[model samples]
Target: MYTMNRTATTEMEVTSIRLERDLKDRLKDLAGNQGYQALIRDVLWNYVQQKSGDYQPQLSPEEIRASVEATAQTEERCVLTGKLIRPQERMLLGLTKSGEMVPLSVESLAR
Candidate 1:
């Protein structure tokens, strides 16, 4: 949910943290050309934004590849509208263009 600001890197402060060798290797593999350090920063920023209530996950209609009807087994928040979905409630699972599954209210896509 967080967008990276590549130009802001020059203002970043150096900080050191320890990581398990296996975890480091996995991050490296996942990061690929972007490099593990930049990926770590993105992961951390997303976590912080989500926890701070500043991150609102949303997708335009074009970004949603498909939607499937589903029943929520647990409470969920609609990614598009931020509406709360109760457990066992009928909902839609929107498959994003990037292949992420996100919760949606039944009326979210209603015409």
Candidate 2:
């Protein structure tokens, strides 16, 4: 049996924070340099979220597992050998005979 943590459902969490006056000024300048007139919490949050798996889309373990399984089952077969591929879900491929994988954009293939 398994249960989901209620707090883990969101990408954003709130807590009281303190900033030194000079640091606050620097942050505000950084925000303004980006063309926003005021500091946005999301921007700071994004900095904190880098590579922490805290800013990913919401998908439960079962759903993710199911998606992976489905992708495996429907892998685009390599035209050369008829072997199943770990499909590049967003792009087409050109399998060179030298066993090198080349990515081809849909637009280029359509032309």
Candidate 3:
């Protein structure tokens, strides 16, 4: 998940590579469905991850929910209660220090 730093005036590397006609057409079709540049970046990133074995493991919905629950206590705060959340409560109904319920993101649950 590499994102460009907007605060820093850094120039990124840009390269032009040639692709076969068939491949290009297929990519273009996918690009039509997704975004051309985004699709290209995703493909390249996936390839790099595969080669380096740096890909993140896929989490099942249950595991994801559990992880979200476990991590909620660390940093996430209930939007309404302004209190830190806990694992036992549903994210949408998370308790704040004030005893209010709220929602949270999945990333906020990760260690």
Candidate 4:
């Protein structure tokens, strides 16, 4: 998961990109106080991390606000345990505190 690094200072290079007016407006609305540019960066970073296989799935029950039963339409890795969930297997879509819906093994929620 991509987290905002508030204390870390890193050099940034400016780049220009064009977006549709409607999309820009939506991003602005979703970003709120964080700003759309930062949101875009976060989205991009998440994509890169996932594609690069650098994402470590580590989540606690406390970080999950709720969960919904689901069946995997495709293979997925549990965000809480890094367990492989095969296609058509029982799983869960956990609603995290950050508002992301992440895959979880069915047993991950067992208490």
Best by lDDT: 4
CA lDDT, every model vs. true structure: 0.83, 0.39, 0.48, 0.85
Which candidate order results from sorting by lDDT in descending order? 4, 1, 3, 2
Q: After superposition, how far is residue 19 of candidate 3 from its true place, in Å?
A: 1.1
- Give the runs in model 3 whose Cα sits over 4 Å from its true position: 1-11, 59-111
Q: What is the lDDT of residue 13 in candidate 4?
A: 73
lDDT of 4 by residue, 5-70 (tens): 754335777688999999999999999998898889888887776667676666888899999999
Give lDDT tens digits, candidate 3, residues 79-106. 3233444555445433444443435543
Q: How well does candidate 4 score on lDDT at residue 80?
A: 74
Stretches of candidate 2 above 4 Å error? 1-15, 33-40, 54-111
* TM value for model 2: 0.25
- The backbone clash count of each candidate, in order, is 0, 0, 1, 0
lDDT of 1 by residue, 14-93 (tens): 89999999999999999999889988988888777655666666566678789999999997777777677889999999
In candidate 4, position 51 carries an lDDT of 63
Pairs of residues clashing in candidate 4: none
What's model 1's TM-score? Answer: 0.70
Residue range 1-111, candidate 2, lDDT tens digits = 111232332564566578787887787777666432224454555445433434332222222111111223234432323333455445445544444443333333331
Best model per TM-score: 4
Candidate 1 lDDT for residue 91: 99
Error of 2 at 10 (Å): 18
